[model samples]
Target chain A: MTSPVVEVSHLRKTYPAAKRGGTPKTAVADVSFQVARGEIFGILGPNGAGKTTTVECLAGLRRSDGGTVRVLGQDPQADPLLIREHVGVQLQEAALHDKITVAEALDVFGSFYSERADPAELLDLLDLTAHRHQQFGKLSGGQKQRLSIALALVGKPQVAILDELTTGLDPAARRATWELVERVRDSGVTVLLVTHFMDEAERLCDRLVVIDGGRVVAEGTPSALIEGLEGDRGVRLRFADDGARERATQLLAALAERDADVTAAVPIGDEIEVTGTRKVLFAVVQELAAADVVPDDVRTLERTLEDVFVQVTGREYRVEENEEVAA
Target chain B: MTAVETTGPVRVNHEGLRFRAFWTLFGTELRVWLREPTGVFFALIFPSLLLLGLGLAVPDFSKPMADAPPPWNEAPGITSYLPTIIALAVGTISLTTMPVQFATFREKGILKRLSTTPMPPQNLIGVHMVINVLALIVSAGAAVVGGMVVLGVPFAADPLVVLLVLVLSTTAMFSLGLLVAARAEKGQTASGLGMLIYFPSLMFSGVWVPLSVMPDWMQEIGLYLPLGAAAQGLTMGWFGNEGFPLAQVLVLAVWTLVLFPLGVKLFRWT
Candidate 1:
């Protein structure tokens, strides 16, 4: 087995309680995970979920309250100078001077490291070659995001930590960022990604940890976690009318009779959502045919990371207001 | 991962890092400051206006008193006021202009972005200090030459004493500016606070008015302030006078030692 490139054990961080007076808020509580060398490890959480604080600690930007975090086998806090040389960090709200041009910023940062990628090469890779002469303040949101990524990669670090890689990007830019991340991973650099986008996590992460209220509630490969749920399969059936909905409910009941582990039959709008195994879903479809209620739309889809997240944590995904405030 | 065997003490290549970081940031600051004529106007032009205005308004009061007074015999009024004005210009540029610049850098996360690299934080501070010190020197030279041509104030011929005074006063003011930059939370706040501290020092530190003309209690108070002592020392050195005020030099030195560490301790990158 390859050794873990990033190791965090029993990590904890606590912020001072608010002025109203209560217990101190635990930003990260007993969080632990390891990213194997050359694999992408993602941390998925809602806003105020301690994602930023956790990555800051890992990057040696903040002192950890408790627990050990080692990047490239060096203690980040104790030896930040050493770790900074090998670890590249792209903070969520990081920015540069308005008057400094993109190429100038890249060249300046490149001078800090012992070994660095050529600024021209990095600009091309990040699609920022054309905007090299543009001042940082003149760039659009997507352009700035691309510049931030270029700055992170200029040092050619062994481990790269990107926080909210595609937070405010349009769909097209988001897809481009995804491709860039995959290419980075393919180049043999370990990536620790912090994102709230479920699809992004499912697509990019080889293994992930779901964090909520400062703790890791679940951790595994996306597929493994989804499969771990008991009778976690889901079926969507759009019916003709209220009569079809009633008949679909009856069909689901018949299918549950065959499997003791079937959990729920929820009706949403004109569709009935059946949650159970592949066997139960197939039986439910046959029962619907027997009842002579032909469904208009019928499809069986695997449970997504979002579904598994909500089910395991009992909390809906919420985008916090402060997520955009940093920008 | 490849491992290398080492038998001797590990050495860090701080020279290369420091040199590279310093020049990179210095070049960036010079380019931005030059391009933004408005910023340069406010930083360099405004202070020059103040110096030329004050130098003209205050006449040679020390010369008339030179015939009667013991201390005034060697240092005349215009000669005394010249060094104080120079010191004030240095104070204005470093303490006021530099802090606001650094605060904006913090607001924009430029400093935070730099912190992620192998460059040490001291190099950033050092670059700012060096650039502002050079600006101060040029401002001082312009103020002296312009004061001579426009205000009829005579320039001192002794370059050695002028150089010594410039070195001491510049170091003292640069360290003070670092203290302000480290403490102020916002750019406007730092600029405002700098003016608040600077205006009073210019008024009571004998930059605009001689301490001898003020009440005895005011003169005693002026001796304790850093700029007041600096002005006193510069005046004594510029005119080839006796009684160099070792006590005042000691006080300024102490201020430098105390404020520099406190400034560094309080400094925030973001």
Candidate 2:
């Protein structure tokens, strides 16, 4: 196999405890992942899952206490200036100078690179040409996010690390940003995106590493991760009348009790859902036929990445930074 | 021009990146500073206003003092205010403006943002220092010209000594400001602390009450202070009395050497 564009091995970082005599929190412990060339790889995790810490290590903003991280075949920490030339970044909490105009920001940031992209083209791509002269503080949240993205791309970097890329954007703006990420990937710039949104990771990432408690619980393409979960794909059956519903429920309960196929069977209103191995489907049809209660629709339910995430981490998957509608 | 390659990492030749980065940052710093009403009022306009207003309006400022003692001779009050004007200009830039902006930029994550790029945070500091030095020089020139042209105050008796005093005094005051900015965790706190030192230093530096007319004990105490030493040194140079003010130069030097290092050590990029 070819070496990845970015690789991290056995990364460990511990933040000192805030209070006296308290044990220091291990922010990242033995976490490892890789990003291939031209792919939009994701690091999906909840708050305090070391997503930012891991990205910081990759960006050379933080020095890991243990393990090695290489970016483009070179150590980011040992030779950060070299890596910096090839790595563009849009930090989660950073803002440009309040009085700096959008055009001026792009112009200045572009000048920092030897291989600069056309600021005008970037402005047009991000839909920021109308606000070229607008001061950064005067721009709306969505506009600010777009301007940061423009600044990040002006260097024409080989890899762009966008942390919490669409955290504060509205649904429409979030979708637009996602499309922009896709376009960036298409243009051959590898992306390492850190996010907490389940739908976002499922939609944008070619492959992602789901981190929890500073460890990688699962890593794969979104569909593969969901399919790889050790459980039956969900099965649902709906019946018209109360009698049919009860009969369906009883049949599913018997199947679950037998433990030959179904793991758990539960009734919801006039419907029954049986969760078990793949063989549970055949078993459920046989039971229903035996009961002679085929007066409803039956279908296999597809599991979402959120469900897989919950299964792997043993915790409810929730986005820490709530999305707000831009005014 | 290198062809735009749509492949793996492009090898960039950074021949003039350093100079371009510094020059661009300096220009931006100057541009942003012009937008600051508070900074403009203090660093550029305030000193000239003091010299022009007091020199033209207050007849007593240019007149010789009454109640002359045996050893002490009467001098026009405008001469005394000169040192204070210079000190205030330096103090306002170093103490009031520098710390407030540095801490605010740090709080707003501007410094951290630059850190991720080829530009380091220290470049911001370097840019600010160079810009402020140029600004203070212009404001200082305005003060001198306004004092001489409007009030008819005599030119410096020893121009070189006056220049030395201004340089050393600015270094001392700015280093103190640097220390405040380095230590304060937030913008407001830095501003508050800077103002605390600024007001007291301004008063003792002869902004409000002339050091010449202050009570003996108070004058003695004020002479040892940074602004106090500065006012005395400049006044002595302009008047050509007490050759070189060796003590004043020593105080300013000691403060610069000590405070500048401490400021650098305590500075936090985040």
Q: Native contacts recovered, in order, as a fraction for each?
A: 0.44, 0.45
lDDT of 2 by residue, B1-270 (tens): 122234444445566877887798788778877987877888888988987888778888877645433121355567668877887788888888899988988887888788778777898888888888998998888898888777766678789988998999989888898999996767899999999999988888888887767778766777788888888888788777668788888888898999899999999887
The per-candidate count of clashes, in order, stands at 1, 1
For B1-270, candidate 1 gives per-residue lDDT tens digits of 222111111223678776876798788767866666665665566655666766556465424345634544554355556777777777777667788878776776667766776776567667767777777767777777766676655566455656665676666666777778885667898888778788887776675566546677766766677777777666666665555567667777777788778878888876
- Per-residue lDDT for A241 in model 2? 85
Considering only chain A, what is the TM-score of each predicted structure? 0.87, 0.87
Off by over 4 Å in 1: A14-25, A231-233, A239-267, A290-293, A300-302, A319-327, B1-14, B36-38, B53-81, B157-159, B206-217, B241-247
**Model 1 TM-score relative to the real fold:** 0.85
Model 1's i-RMS, to one decimal, reads 4.9
At residue B122, give the lDDT of candidate 1. Answer: 61
TM-score of chain B of each: 0.80, 0.90
